[model samples]
Target: MHVRTWADRINNLREINTLRNQIFVGFTLTMILVLVFAGAFIYGEVSVLLKQSAEKHIQQTAIQANGRLDVLLKQIDSLTTQVVTDSYVQKLLLKEAKGMPSNFNERQSLLQIANNYMAYSSGISSLELYTLDNRRLFPLDDSSIKRISMNALTQADEKKGRIAWVGIDPRVSDSVLAIRRINLLDNSYLPGGYLVVHVYREYFNMYESETEKEEKNPFRSRELMLLSDSEGNPIISDLDDEAAKSVLAQTGSTVTLEQESMLAVRQQSKVADWKLVLLMPVEAATEGISVLRTAIFVSIGIAALAFLLLTLPLSTMITRPIQQLMRSMRRARFGGLRVIPDGRNYFRTLEINELNNTYNQMVTHMNELIQVVYEKEITQSRTELKALQAQINPHFLFNTLEAFYWSLEEKEESELAQTILAMSGLFRYVIGSAADNDERVTIRDELEHAQRYLQIMKMRLIDRLHWFIEADEQLLQVPIPKLIIQPLVENAILHGVESRISPGSVTIRVFSAKPGFATIAVIDDGVGMDGEALNKLMQSIEGVPSQEPKKGAGVAMSNVQRRLKLYYPNTNERGSGLQIDSKAGAGTTVSFDITIPPEGDGLS
Candidate 1:
């Protein structure tokens, strides 16, 4: 056995010539495509939406970080400017500028001012005052001195007493600095000293900690935040070295580290001239998309199942009645005529209902036509039998005249008169029946007609002829076809008795063998037939035309057989039409049975 592939199964379905299969295939495929397309469309739209949300969240976080950083830097700028511009702090810087070695009291006074500013601002970690020659002026202990870089001094000197905010200082890596020059209080502006304020990284963390405390925190645990210098060197970052490098190398607002794409939003701090960047991994940002995809798949599956369930009833509603109609049509094709009852009300579709109604009408009309044709055929067969009898008139006339001659020679005037009267009665009955439209007559009347013909035959055969008719009184009034018994009796005389040298007798039997049925037979003990002749005789009687026609018992038997069949079309006593029993040199018996119709039933 070979397993069938889906393609093969689909092809088999296509090969099935049915409305249901076709509908199922068409709708199933359409539903599948719709579900797939809908899933893809939903997934695509959700993916874009998730990506946009990640971008927006990251950009907002960067902007918030920048705003807070600017606030911190401004507060530091205010505190440092107060310390640098203080009159006493400026006087001590002037002494240092005039080549006077500052005394302990003077250094202590500058220390006191610096300490005051540090106490006022928590973001200020330390404040260092430097001479124009890069000497540590305030807190003048040589061991505790922090010499400012020429780069910081030159940048401050160019600003001319204005504050210059810088990223994390190289010498003090943990802190960001705000540098400014203190100018002498003279008409000629000259650099008195340099003020260096170190704002610790803890200041930035304090702002970040506040953000994390909010309910909808943009800087979640999965995110990486970085604060970089103008030259793209990171001053403060939560990223490792490799991740920080990836963030700083960004050309656009997105970056990738460790093969995972991240949403990177960078903003430049207005006061500090630093870049604040937020990095959010795509997986963390769009975590809900995975769940959305699962929901989409599940929804599609449910829709498919629902559609399948609906298709069964949908196809059934249309195809069930059609299948029933098809079976009825098949039966009708085989001659079983019937109408679908209440067909119009049985179906949902108007077209199918109309078709069913049309089928019923056609069957009814066909039955009518069949009945008409059946009647015409029966009438035509009876007319043909009458015509056959007419063609035998001269033969019958010659036989009757020969019987009269025999009666004159063998009998006196009274017997001769009886013979002539018998001939006249036979002629009258045969002629009267030929013109009659009704083919059926009572068994008693048919026997009387047969007796007339037999009386004539008795006069002709004399000692060689013998006849007997045993008819039940109850069956005598049962209607059978006209000339039914007479033909069998005549065939018995012609084939069985006439050729025999010994005296032979013909017996006519009319009796009820069972309830509702009557059997009629004409039997003769004379020269009989073999199986071959009997077979031919039976075949001819059954309407199988002979190749070589002859004047034999078969012709008369066929006429009687046809009339019996047409009259009692539904009769099948043993078998239909006639039953003939014979053997070579034995005897012959031709008989039939008729169903007794109810009183007042004219089975026309």
Candidate 2:
């Protein structure tokens, strides 16, 4: 019944979609199963223990009863021996065997002695004496004298005066008997007479009385004892005839009698060829087991109730936050950007609280984003207008420079015209590349732009600086960043040559460093820096702050280094980025490498 209820509950639980209900149902079923199995195991072990204890008790009782019976049989044997060996009885038996008549006084005295023996003994009813021809001798009255079986007589004769146990006296009611043969002490040693001792059935019933007295409680087990003869027929039994026979036929330690389970034990009597069987019902032996079962099930029931009570609230506590979060999200989806109420002060799990906080933060960010996007749109429109207005500035500057160049050529000032033309081309290149937002240009175009920059520089510095350009024609078509080389030249002229008192020479070298790489170097023999200044410059170019900030060359070098890194972000070649080497009053070299892409692959 309990199993069916639990199965039904589990099936119902499966229909519940809520997380709280699922957790509660799952935990409750697990606890119930554990308690049920534990209770069953304990009940089984205790039942076996009770049965084993009953078996031991029954076996002990059987052994004790069998011992008592042996002691009684031994007393009966001794009584028979004493009677057969009596001097008076012996002489009388001899006289009777000789067909001699015995006096009345002698017979009376013998009867008195026999009566005394029976009167003083326990459980002994009467003693019978018979001659060899089956004539009664000692008992003058024949009314109560029970006739013994011929088989008993034969068994006694074979014993040679030893007592032989016969289970019950056949001609007597409720009496058990033993027989012995008297042998004549003469050269012709032969049977003189036979002696039979009768004992009341109370001899067996006395043990049963004692057993009942010891266990006075009528509700306790009632152990039945049966004494069976050598032929397996019941001689004395506490059970009825049929029940005794049925019990005797059973071989196992437990039996079922009268629809009740019984524990059976058997013992053999030493002084008689008899078996004693003891039967005790199992229900009476383990009477307290019912109470134990009740207590266990009740305790399990109470525990399950307590667990259910606890589980409901615990599952609610766990899922309550998530449910609230869901409701909050539903509101936000329909109601526009709105922050969820803060729950940090409430007693809740960390992860759920974190989720709530994250949702609130997202809502706040969305509200702020609305204002930011509005302002950004207005600013973008204004910036676009300004950009449209500024587009003609570069073209205007180039055309004016072009007109100046033509005027100088018409005046035959060819060097001045060439310089103006170089200036105009340089401006166009810078402005065009920036507007396109594409930094890549062929090595040839980059070198030409750098030469134009150097031409303008020479016009300003004159003899203070001399510059030369070296190149490998095959490598001129390799692509590089547009202003990469020009920055290095600017740094050389500004930081190296401007500070020198004597004329300084600057060399630009562009050639293949290896099969797939090109090196562009700007070398200048100017007033080079010492170790401290060089270290400061190096740190500055790598975007590290120095205690003393240097501008001009430092700013140009830093920009060029950043551009080279962005252009070739994954290049692993040793001299792939801007490298600087300088010594005090010797020279400074600024160089970088370009990786040539494969024939058909796009440049990263």
Residue-wise lDDT of candidate 2 within 1-604, one digit each (tens)?
9999999999887758788888999999999999999999999999888878877777777777788888778878877778888888888888888988666676667788798778767788888888787677777744322366678888788888898877777777688777888987651667898888888877865253555756763532377778887777788888888988888888987887877778888898887788888777778788778988998999899999999999999998988888887787788767676776775546588898888889889888988998999999999998998899767666778889999999999999998899999999999888874456676878888889989999998899888879999999977777787788888888888888887988888899998757877788999998888898888898988889877786664787888888888777645545346777899988899888778887654333
How does each model score on lDDT? Answer: 0.79, 0.81
**TM-score of candidate 1 versus the correct structure, residues matched by position:** 0.55
Candidate 1 has which clashing residue pairs, if any? none
Model 1 has a clash total of 0
- Candidate 1 accuracy as lDDT: 0.79
Clashing pairs in 2: none
User: Across residues 1-604, which tens digit of lDDT does each residue of candidate 1 receive?
Assistant: 2456877888877769589877887897899899999899989998999889888877777787788888877888788778877888777778777889787777777777788778988878888887766577666765322445567667777778888866677777788866888887752667787787788876875234645545456447677788877767777788776678776886776677788887788788887667888888888888889999999889989999999999978887888888888888888777678898664444479888888889889989998999999999999988998788667554477567667756776766767777787776676666653455466778898999899888889888998889999998978888877778888888888888887998999999988877888889899997788998888888788879877655774788888888777766656536668888999989988888888889877434
